[model samples]
Target: MDDRGGAPAPPEKISAVPVRHPGRWVAAAVLLVLAAMLVHSLLTNPNWKWAVVGQYLFAPRVLHGMLLTIELTALAMAIGIVGGVIVAVMRLSPNPIVSGIAWLYAWFFRGTPVLVQVIFWSFIAALYPYLSLGIPFGTEFVYFDSNKLVPIFVGVVLGFGLNEVAYMSEIVRAGILSVDRGQTEAAEALGMTRTKIMRRIILPQAMRVIIPPTGNETISMLKTTSLAAVVAVGELFTTVQLIYGSNYQQIPLLVVASLWYLVLTSVLSVFQYYIERHYARGTVPLRARGFRFGRAQGGLS
Candidate 1:
């Protein structure tokens, strides 16, 4: 049954695919209700004291403590990252003893609470009373005062770095394991040594997996430094506590500390997003060119 010059057409058929439910209206209603509640709360709250918050915002001690917090976070993260890589490599070593040692380190540090470790390091003198340094088979060459060993900075770094190493070791191990086995085999087939294979081929690919979790850990570590307040380290929160204790403006002073933490975390999150995008360049789908807001138009008339 050709109408003009074409051959007979196939029979028409109906499609069987199910239509997806559109939930935009439901979502919009929920969002509107939330906005209304937030606006009402802001209007009704009695403690919206901007003047009090502004009064101590730039106090010298507060600024100094903020700087100290940044310093502690940087130092601890640096040591943790370096030591974590070493422990991760050792855990994956061919030697049984090395692997066992790394395993034990990760297990113990991760199992214990970080606050307990901080207190222990802060009060190490109570147990040992002195520190001796020398070769195992030789006489002690140097003796240090135990009282000087557990300074505020030393205690914070030791506690944070050791705890971070345990967590980062697991992150690194997972990153290394995520590389395909065939990649190693291919590198071997090309006459690359184990070290070269790991450095050039495996690690590059593993970075994709490593960066995201590492960023999250970095943010967590920044916040965890607040725990040092318990040991009187004079970081941001401790400084806030001192101020509030003396001045009795607890809410505003505490709010300043909270705002600083919020700002730092927000900045870290932005960097994390950029780092993720850089590593994810080739693995994920790219946004289509000129595809604005779910519309597609480039067809000819």
Candidate 2:
């Protein structure tokens, strides 16, 4: 025992207890074998028409459509996020009427089918042929066909972006709510304006919560752009449809689109992981704790 003032120290630590889980090893081997078999089967399958997939993977028409899809996704997400934040803020307003209006907007958008909205907008000329700009009842400075004003692309954007605003508003609202009430109170006590508090204090912290879901929504928005096909917007899937229609090779063409979507989503997922890590600086990261990378000590084999 060391001759200090306190009781004798305990014996020096001998070793960590054995962390045994034989079942895990067995499960890993089984999963590996199954994965190998699956890969082998996929490679050997003759009907998959992998050559066709490779041929169309980077086809010109497909690339054009991909560009359109990307454009639509970017526009939709940009507008949706901006509109969503506005709606989320309005939903949190102290005024009952403001909050009620925001609630109704969210409810209607969320409740309706997005496809219906797209089709409705696409044929809006039938509903209201002329959309006049000027005072509502006094003056008509200009007028244009509803369909011409809200063309197929604009219609698709309205459908997707408007619907997305509802969902994204909820996501933003939830993130904002996740911030401690004390923070808002403290900011108020400091005589900060509501806008300033939201911008500088609350929103920055809320972003740690907001970004992951927003990333997910962005990826989802990418896929959701496919729905614009029904509105005759020439997006990636729609381009694939046009190609397959001509050649009558629907499955192979679809496989091509699938590959592109998978690649894009995979890239986005990696981006999201880094973004999440960036926000999670002060917190213990789950990835770092999941698996130890260095060489292990002697095992009880």
Candidate 3:
């Protein structure tokens, strides 16, 4: 009811306008120009030798080398994951000696360059020509020649695996530490053993933190296996080197290796995405959790 005994007049309409971002337009134009230039250079440069890349991309020897690379990656990561978990638990041990030894292992492996470690393992026979298994300081029951025991492939795997163990230990330790102390105490209150608490309560919750870095390490291991080329381990890079060494088609062969690595890493990345999504259930909205890989609902396309 209005004071004049009539309905009040409707409020006047107000208009609104969207904001403009001129800087975004400028940035987009610059990026487009750079991309066009790069594409033109790649297409016009006669030296890329795309035909040779195509020719040797699926060659028998190349495929064999790729298979070896995959094997090395899988084995190394398996060793790293298992060894890392053990070392991580050792690092958290109450005994000073155990913790100190674990710390020293991580320090030594992480402080040195991986290439140096690989080379050292490759030539370790020079340090100790024989290895024995028996009592620590008593009669030996079995002996093995170092040269036979640690071949180039085994040496390379040990190098990659041990070095990765150091890195993954720290990663696992961080994940374990990320879990709340209250949870462990609560588990203790419920009469759970320490091992049970860790296995059933802490680790499951900690996996969300552990998984992303572990996935990254796996992908990194895929690329780092190329280092085996230095020791003539016949991996992808080594195979490519042998091919290009004879034909002098170094650039194309390298491009082939790079393409294969990109493809493998891309596949690993997709797996990582799904693994992260699985562990992220109940914490984040599904649509906003990771890359959608689908139609955009709104915002920047």
> Model 1, range 7-64, lDDT digits (tens) per residue?
8888789888977656977888999999999988756775756577787788899899
- Each candidate: what lDDT? 0.86, 0.89, 0.94
How much does candidate 1 score in TM-score? 0.84
What's the best-to-worst order under lDDT? 3, 2, 1
Q: Residue 117: error of model 2 in Å?
A: 1.9
Worst 10 residues of 1 by lDDT: 286-295
Q: How do the residues 60-142 of candidate 3 rate in per-residue lDDT, one tens digit apiece?
A: 99999999999999999998999999999999999999999999999999999999999999888999899999998899999
- lDDT string for model 2 (1-301, tens) is 4678788898888888999999999999999999999998779987677888899999999999998998998898887899999999999999999999999999999999988887887787888989888987798998897867888788888888898899999999998999999999999999999999999888888888899999999999999889888877999999999999998888889999998899888988999999987887767554464634444634321
**What lDDT does model 1 reach?**
0.86
Badly placed stretches (over 4 Å) of model 1 are: 1-27, 189-191, 288-301
TM-score of each: 0.84, 0.84, 0.91
Of 1 and 2, the candidate ahead on lDDT is: 2
User: Clashes per prediction?
Assistant: 0, 0, 0
